[model samples]
Target: MYGYIKGVVKKVYPSHVIVENNGIGYLIISPNPYEYKLDDEAIFYTYLHVREDVFSLYGFKSEKILNLFLKLISVSGIGPKSALGIVAFDDTDRIVQAIELGDVKYLTKFPGVGTKSAQQIILDLKGKLIDDEVEIKLISDAGKDVEAALVSLGYNKADIKRVMKHINVDQSADQALKEALAYLLK
Candidate 1:
């Protein structure tokens, strides 16, 4: 339910930061946790995540990053940890680029993400991100139109989907489709 947290940094650790708002302390996990400083006032765009067994706060340096994290988590098979890993070393542009280019190798470099999980991320989030502040260029003209074309040409959607899952956002739709098709045929 919380949106953002503005407070003084009480303590900074290698993986988490403690922010003091009023008299309470919030332990926030961040991709680059050490980017914050102790005693410095800062604003963290936060997401309060609660499950059956745990409650935690995940913070981001910018609203764009926070929104990206939320979008990543919405994907099926993607959890908060996976989303955090995607955004930890990669930014919004990098993710979009990975999807557009169908770069499974690059995406798999992130912690906890494997070939299947990476494909799932593309299936769920491809062309679904809201373009507000982040400038994500659509590499495809018709948004998965190429995949549809491949399907119409007798290829199975599931196979095409699997192929497209590795593409990055920086590559054009035509490029991704061609690459995905090649991967599938190989």
Candidate 2:
């Protein structure tokens, strides 16, 4: 029944973080727990997975990632751990693109996903996962340059995609790059 948690990260483990809120520490499993540094105050969009033997909370920095994780676990044969593993190691856009494009090979590269599971994911989610707000488009020449610059500076495509939506495509490459760097650094 818990939705999101706002707290300071008390501990960061390889697979999960402990977030302390209202004097209670919550064990929240996450894809990249290291993304949360100790003592960082933040909000985590959460998913509570309940089973006969387990009661667990999975958290993500963004609601988009939380939604993706929910969709993944909805597919037959995919569980919370497998879905977490997929999102943990890959970019969100890349995973959506793979499903939309029916790239079973790309899906299979994730841990716990084999050929059959990949096909099932494509079959179930191919046309359903494209976010209404974020549509992937072909980047302009200037956009490509800006993306490359961001990649070189250690930003991933998922982060680039999130920031690129706010960039002006008509701007000059240098201007666009400058704008992208500013948005990304924020």
Candidate 3:
């Protein structure tokens, strides 16, 4: 039960990082491995997943992400990998609010989460998440749909996010799309 590890980063893969401590290198999977650089010192909160065939260690940049990952894996259909995906969703407060509010549509935006799994997430974790009161300004179903549409039309999500800051109040997915594109092109 490795609760945490502090070491110098040896190598960083897209999905994992190798940290060296006490003459040994430990490979730890992280949601965003690029956050840790080679030869940099870091303390990663960790969880060890044990199974019949394999054992793996997952590291998180923060306790909130680690806790969220644990909660995600507790769901019936979610494994550690899927849970990691959910944790990688980038906004812990928004995700917790979505689950607390039973927003399946929002959950589906996470990688590896489908409709059935989204609903299962709502059923299994509703009211169990920490209510962090993060102003979830526009992560609604409509907002996510619009974002997806923009991505399909060749806009990157990060660029869309920058443009979205100029969008006005909530609108239907279609209306949001038009407004978003208008702002983006400007």
Q: Which stretches of candidate 2 lie over 4 Å from their true place?
A: 133-186
Worst 10 residues of 1 by lDDT: 130-139
The TM-score of predicted model 3 comes to 0.70
TM-score of each: 0.71, 0.72, 0.70
Indicate whether candidate 2 or candidate 3 has the larger TM-score: 2
Residues 1-186, candidate 2: write the lDDT tens digits: 888999999999988999999999999999999988899897999999999999999999898899999999999999999999999998898898778657799999999999999999989996578655654454567887888888898987678777776777557999999888888777
Q: C-alpha displacement of 50 in model 1, angstroms? A: 0.9
lDDT of each: 0.78, 0.87, 0.82
lDDT of 1 by residue, 143-172 (tens): 366667777889764565555545542467
How would you encode candidate 3's per-residue C-alpha lDDT over 102-125 as one tens digit per residue? 678888988899999999998888
Q: How close is candidate 1 to the true structure, as a TM-score?
A: 0.71
Which is the leading candidate under lDDT? 2
- Name the candidate, 1 or 2, with the larger TM-score value: 2
Task: Give the lowest summed-lDDT range of ten residues in model 2.
Answer: 130-139
lDDT of 3: 0.82
